[model samples]
Target: MRRQPSMLYLRPFMPLIVGLSLGFTLCLVCLPLLEEGCTSEGSVDQVARLRKPNSVQETQDNPKPAKSGGKQPFRARYISTELGIREKLVVGVITSRETLDTVAVALNKTLAHYIHKLLYFTGTRNVKAPGGMYVVTHGDDRPVWEIAQTIRYINDHFHKDYDWTYLVTDNTYVQGERVTDIFDHISMNRDVYMGKRVPFRDMDGYYCKVGITEKDGTQAFSQACILPLCRGEDVCLFVCLFVTMETILDLQPDEWLGRCLHDVMGISCVGEAEGVDYHTYEFSSTTDPDNEDSQEFQKAHTVHPVVEPTDLYRLHRRFAHIELDLLYPPIQTLNPCFPAQIKNLSHKTPEGEAGLTWPIGINPPFKPQSRFDVLSWDYFTETHLYTCPDGAPKCELQGVDRQDVDDIITTSVQRLNDKYQKQGLTFEHVRLLNGYRRFDPTRGMEYELDLLVGETGPDNIRDVVTKRVKLLRPLSQVEIIPMPYVTETTRLYVILPVTVHDREQVAKFLDSYAQVVLDIHENSALTVVFIYDPLDAQNIQEEDVFGMLKSMITYYERKYPNAKIPWISIKTDVPTQLKIMDIISKKHPVDALFLLVTVTDELTIEFLNRCRMNTIAGWQAFFPIHFAQYSPELIYDTKPYPATVEFGKEFGHFDVHAFDEACFYNSDYMSTRTELQKQRKENEDVSETYNLYEMFLKHSNLHVFRAVEPDLRQRYMPRTCNPHLSEDLYHSCLVSQAEGLASKEQLAKLIFEHDNEIKSQAENVVKS
Candidate 1:
């Protein structure tokens, strides 16, 4: 019927036939290599894999290991110890109906791998939960009560099969590897209830305390004193339980579980302790905005309320990268065909340590490598804290004596009372109620104290009435620590020097700024300053440009009423921007920062923080190297060009060093202008070519040159906005004819060889 099945019919299955033949040939090739009497218990999987090369294989327990093998796709298997943990532990993600989809995404991204017995529970009925999660029939509206019922269900069912149960919310991100290690030390038989323990207060303002007692009802632990309640009622479900709608209604799902467990299982809520310390809570997502760098985030067993799907992915990606690096360290080259050779294998016996294998010549076969070694407790348990360097100026009162602080507070209160009496003020609460310090190095100190003094009645000591008084101290001997003023929260100011060519350019600029403002407003206290001349716009009306700018600002202000969106617009020449900067820096708070960027530049929150940290008052500045794009004419041209294009490909010549657009500096770094003026007079030849970046580097005490990856790609501005030229034609003419004239690699190599010479030349210029 098909003329004996022609070559065309077999062409579709050619890849499959070739793949099978190759796999079979490799197995045949490998089988003869193993010498006689070389077989051992550890070699079974390897032999099996060779015999049936095309067989579908599942990892013994951890089926889907979260190992990122980029070019090498072979995953290291889980060890016996890690597999045992997977069999014993069960994780339940407690979620509400509204956040189920978000929770599912989080679980799949982070915890789905390695955790064998993963389950999720919600309160909505008749709704299909993804990944075979559980759903309850009732109590969907009351999420708090639903959580209580969920716990009871877990304890009833899971305690028999699973040794430990960890319940977290949909938004919580649990570091599974860290959690398992913590559970290894904890005993399932013991009374264990662990979370971030929050002190609970009743409707009547009485604190709830948990008292330990013997089985016979005698108190075994000291009890915290309870405050008196306004309406005394019998709300005790236990020995001391205060329940009210005003109080219990606001209890979060975690708090509700803690209370429910105390009543049902008779165990108190506990936190970090000896041999078991893993739980830490953060109520918000902590992700680095620019690079999604996990190193910047606080190290904890769990980070909670990572509500955004994107944030969950960020945390997962970074954490997975960390694990992958630990497993296959970058120092060692990995082989795709063979198992990784692990040097520090955990299961080595003393005999094996003495270079003895089970068989005569072969080394003991590799079992699936364990990610965490036996002595890796320190890696998981050690806490990382930020500390100021010794001999550095610290903001806190670190070395000062405690008694001296007490004496100062007491003396300041007395002086305030004396002033209050003279002023005939009825504010009698002049005693030291509370006090805090904020430091300004320029001014000595300003201590803001809350003083309380009362007029006692003759009848009873308890009848004494008090009034609150706020005082600032400049009293005879006591010095004050000045705090930041309310209006001085903004630390960085961005200055934009713009030239508008057309309505299209203006629109693009506004759109870019709007996105930047949205990204930064929540996290940063900063302002934007626009420096441009109205007459510079050759295509659009100056008035229309101003109106557009105003509209953008107004829209943001109305949408985010609480956030202060400060935009300062100045119509001036480009050189005048520096003078405005000098004026602003002189008046702004100490260590206030400034940045220079074009209107087209997009900024990230991470870069802004980097700007703040790198720039120190009168000391250092950041002059970031930028990527200069190649000519658009060569890019869009159908004909061959002089140099090869490297824009999107690996090792491709896309960007080159020409101009730097971004500079970050603090108030004290304004010596740039002064130094430039001196240089111009001293050596007129070099002054004309000496740029702002070079001047900043020469004047500042310390200068850091960092390359901005995914750099600020400035839009091309034509020499003239000619009415005859079309938009596309104008773009092509913007790039100079000399550009794309030579290979980028040659230029890069030349620069690299002469880097030292260039530095020496700069130094010589400074000396002159």
Candidate 2:
């Protein structure tokens, strides 16, 4: 080089010299044409045109050299240029009638230009399928049939001109520009398909676990020529196309298409063993693009399973302005490129067979342990000293030791003291009582405490008093037990009228009803009163009526020896019935009063329990009375009134009326009924006597608890309201004369039927 530059050293400059000479020759060729057709001004325009074409063509065909005067090799430059640009591709969308209204509409607006055709399949022939879309009818509901038909339709209609066929559900979301950018590195002329990839092992595990297997205990598939067809519709579709193609690009391994190809079609996806230029994404059903993760959004080419129509529109607006240059770094700042190593691939033997072992030093998600630390306490022997309200020893002791109990009590007291101290108040002496513990069936464990509160501290300022403190525990750790008997104060008075024709029927009704009354035990008291017509007493004999009523009390007393029975019988007419009611009200006030016109219905234990619990909860007014047909056997065959009767309407007439006979009134409410009856008689338009009483109660603003039990209604038949019967006769007269009184066996069967109904109802309440 020091001596002189050789020919080889100057060779690189020859191409520039040759390019300049070519440009000069092009100008020379145009000089004759320019001179013959132009003046001096026009000749400059002709020369400019000749230089511009040559310069532009050369710039487009060649790559600029680096500052070091070295140009990229010819083959490398050609490959890089080809990878950077791609021809416009045609895309086809497959949808169905079910999704056409939601997903198809979104696709039409978002990817209209890219869409070659929108193919919709439906089973119905009269759908009046939309115009400008291809519609296919095949009576099958399976997705496989629709997919297969769509492929055939595209091939036949488009003449194999499409670059890519994106098979997607109506719910999938895609960006047309992003999809185009992903294909830039891909060669469309080659046999290539890109989608999410799924592994074979994962798919096989899911199918085997779900019991989708064959007689040989392996995953099952339908027969399709020599190759077995996969169960998944998407898997089958891509595989069918793969059989005719060379290279299949699996985009996402976790998604359906990739899973199917690997598991069902026995295809090894590309990305699992190599790095890919394009990115695959799956947006969760719960994701919203307005608050999406920025890093995740930037990496994705296609986001799948976006079923929401609003999200599809939003996704389109986000990437509509994104240019391909923004997605990659600037060329001047770019580092030398290197191929990435394969990720998450299984180990292979020297012979290329997949090995059973994974990479060393890998850890499981969690550490294995035999036992876990839970909040537990040590039980003491003294815990067994507690007794139930009945003085019966509790079966089990779920309590902590003395030290722990003392610590809990001390901590609780300290917290209370600290809170009051902030308000310039403090407790004096605090002491645990004789260590007495009691078990409340409903409230769980409790302890008796003795404490003194005064400003003088503990210096003879106050006396120590006892108080009950509920033993506290986590609700999850508590076990609840049903109380053996009701404990709340509940009283019910049943008023009934007995007549000559129905004296025996009334006795039977009282007999069965008393069984439910006795079940209430010491928690509640019941008084049953029988009213007899003085006129009917003359024919039936008063002693006989009294004897029948007394017999009912004797039967219940003997049956429930432990329960207290209180009952009385009085002789009265309609006018004097209210007077008798007043006398009984003063003698033994009740929580509720029930007027029984007929005793054809059975009462459930649950209803009786609810009555007691409601009373305890301060419900003192109306309790809902459900109605049923007069005949039990006809209940299912005949329809019931849809609603409670409105004011002044007869039963079964307007589908809304009071259940006069079955209604329960607060004892205080019943006491005010004498004045209501007086008001009713004073009104000039007294077409109906029964419903007027209900209207009076409604105006009083009394609280009404809806205790309508459908099961109870079936057993409790409605009072006979036949207009054919004499109005003067007691309502029970019709019931007594009515045939088909349920025998003891039938009554037992009714109780059994209600048992399951109540249990299921309780479970639903607890769950809710």
Most accurate candidate by lDDT: 1
How many angstroms is residue 446 displaced in model 1 relative to the true structure, after the best TM-score fit?
61
For residues 564-605, write the lDDT of model 2, one tens digit per residue: 557656665442334445556666546544433344444556
TM-scores for all predictions:
0.29, 0.26
**Which segments of model 1 are wrong by more than 4 Å?**
1-86, 131-139, 202-242, 263-266, 279-286, 289-298, 325-768
lDDT by residue for model 1 over 293-354, one digit each (tens)?
Answer: 44424355666566676677766666665666567544344653233233234237554445
Q: List residue ranges in candidate 2 displaced over 4 A.
A: 1-489, 494-497, 500-511, 519-522, 539-546, 562-564, 571-580, 590-598, 613-620, 627-658, 661-667, 674-699, 705-707, 714-768
Q: How many pairs collide in each candidate, listed in order? A: 11, 13
Q: Could you tell me the lDDT of residue 383 within candidate 2?
A: 39
What TM-score number comes out for model 1? Answer: 0.29
